[model samples]
Target: MFILVGITDLPWLQKLLFVLVLFFYILDVLGNIIIVSLVMRDISLHSPMYFLLANLSFVDICFSSITVPKMMVGFFIKNTITLQGCLAQMYFFHFLGCTEGILLAAMGYDRYVAICQPLRYGTLMRNTVCIQLVLASWLIGLTTSLVHAIMTSYLPFCNSNRIKHFFCDVKPVIKLACADIHLNEALLTNVLGFLSTSTFSLTIVSYVYIILKLMKIRSSQGRSKAFSTCSSHLTVVSLFYGTAMCTYLGPSSENSIEKDRIAAVLFTVITPAMNPVIYTLRNQEVKKSLKKLIKHEHL
Candidate 1:
């Protein structure tokens, strides 16, 4: 069993943190569910873009669910997790996270095709193609997460089993291992790093092409419309990759645990909660659909 340090030691602060985290977790789950439901029910939203977005919303639900509930439970009870439980948490955490990363990249590509190659949008981003992209993302995420979980499980944990973070994150859990962690660290740096960098690169490249296309449009309104279409996605991507890179790519050491925890909160807890707001407020189509749903329900 491993004892989690949790977010704070002060009883008063712990209460405050619990209330705040509960609020955000509820918001995250409900907002994502609403998005998923909207996309599934609304015929107008049955496009490649919305399909990818609904998938993203679903991933967000699972991603936040993996850690937040456990973290919340730690507030009132002893923050102890069993060996198997820790590994399972680590597995699903990375699985959903990696899947979301790749899904975002695919969303970027969908936007790129829709805006830049309008004529080919229907043909290029057909239903089968989008389904394949989602499936590929899930397969890749599963494979990578399995490797991490299996490798970390093999490490002997004869040392202190106290995790410095609120949950069983890869870095924090691996730090408790008695065995040589150089290979584990290398895998974290190389395998996970490649996944992050490659998916991030894909998103960047798609946006680059998208921006160039927008520049060619003579009408300011055309550019604005195009930019608006992708703004929500770009915002979400920035929030996710920014915190994720800080946590993973930054120097790992005892001194950085606090920083990692903060970064983890941003991506894992805050970002998911904010996604629906970002999409709904910025996206006219989504807002309209939401309003329609609300009005119809009242009748």
Candidate 2:
């Protein structure tokens, strides 16, 4: 299917956007790679939280790769994707996006156990359990995305193949189908809603309890310390869920393409670029480990 991407008229605008997109893409890849490297090598960062965080960094790397590279190409070359290529992109986009959603929830739960159940944190979130949780997140992502991708890829595309928005978003892709897409719509709205909402709900519940537990700490220092551990996660969640919900949760209106595209950029591209920065800058332990890793590499 031939996909037209971005503002086509103004060459100047496209050039500017290409540079911006390339810059963000570079930042996302480099920052997440550093996080993964530091987390893996630093003995101090081998805990459950950092373990989940490393998985997140890896997810961010894959997630952005699914779309941003193609987007960068859109500015320079013929902005067309083959049917097979579009289907592949759609599948992996959902796969990695869903994985990141679940992993974020897992991270939230990790923080909950760390702060709320400090006494039993060891038994509750053992190495085996952490591995199980990580595996389950990927499994769920793969299963959910495979089903949706199969269903979507099979839909007859007799209509025009030009996708309205950039990339192979489910909604935009579905709109191109000439066949009655009620089922697709239902699945997109209800199934995706269920998947995203469920994980988002889990994250919310975890943080709610974490906040309540922090409130009980009598010492101001104690409360601050507990809150500090989770502040970065909360900020990341807000950025991710904010743009994601706006993009996916609502009704698909025709006029919302520009809005959707902008929101999509924030959700898919900018958020991933910012995640490593948010985690590393706000996290003292990560900073320390990063410094040590840099020094060791230099030596």
Candidate 3:
């Protein structure tokens, strides 16, 4: 039988990965903290769009925290993780992901309501409605992760003990199952695919309508001004969906390790770090409010 080995057996590469992972998470934390602080402190940002943006920033913070720190510690400490650690990591990892996915959809809907139904934006996304959406997103997050976790735990891991990457991603963990995980694989792929993709497609369609509406504006200045508002949101959406969908939809094999890792780094590491900067820097209203706040404080 061929010997099965993992990163624990390869010391040097793990150290390098550890440094890179820490750097990514540190950036994510710093950027997200700035966003949350700005949103909470600035009274002018108490609208639906900024509120959703704030919640999105919060989700990204929780999402990255789920995996990065443990990997950093694992690098200097024992490379091995306990079964309990594996399960906990898997739970929070997937849980935050599901929550973020739903929140992204909610964000898109918020944008859609703002752009397409401008007259009713306030009435449509009132405080009670926004709170309900946030609560529902959390509920969906826990429920989806619970299903995946219970399924993963019951699967027999008779032959191998090593997880492919730094964390216990569902796909990599399921691959190690000695039992036939084909059914579980199919269930996960189909359900999660529809969940993520349906929302993604809706987001794209919503933006298409938004751009169409912007083009109808009489003045070139009006059009440019309106389209500029969408620039950051569109960029964040593209980065997130592009990387995440590729990882979930693309085929995986031993030979695909490099590609998968690149996708993982983009989806889990880089994208979270980018969200806060994108929101704050691209938003004129936010920048104005922040500048005014700093000026007042200095005065």
lDDT of 1 by residue, 202-254 (tens): 99999999999999999999899999999999999999999988888866798
Winner on lDDT between 2 and 3 is 2
lDDT of 1: 0.94
lDDT of 2 by residue, 1-299 (tens): 56766545478888998888888989999999999999888899989999999999999999999998888788877689888888899899988988999999999999999998999999999999999999999999999888778888788898887787778888888888889888887887787789888999999999999989988899999998888889999999988888888877888878666678888889778999999999999999999998998898899
* Displacement of the residue 286 alpha carbon in candidate 2, Å: 0.2
Candidate 2 Cα misplacement greater than 4 A, ranges: none
Model 3 CA deviation exceeding 4 Å by range:
1-19, 293-299
**Estimated TM-score per prediction?**
0.99, 0.97, 0.90
Task: Determine the C-alpha RMSD for candidate 1 after optimal superposition of all C-alphas.
Answer: 0.7
lDDT of each: 0.94, 0.88, 0.77
Ranking by TM-score: 1, 2, 3
lDDT of 2: 0.88
lDDT of 3 at 48: 75
True lDDT of residue 197, candidate 3: 92
Q: Using TM-score as the measure, which candidate wins?
A: 1
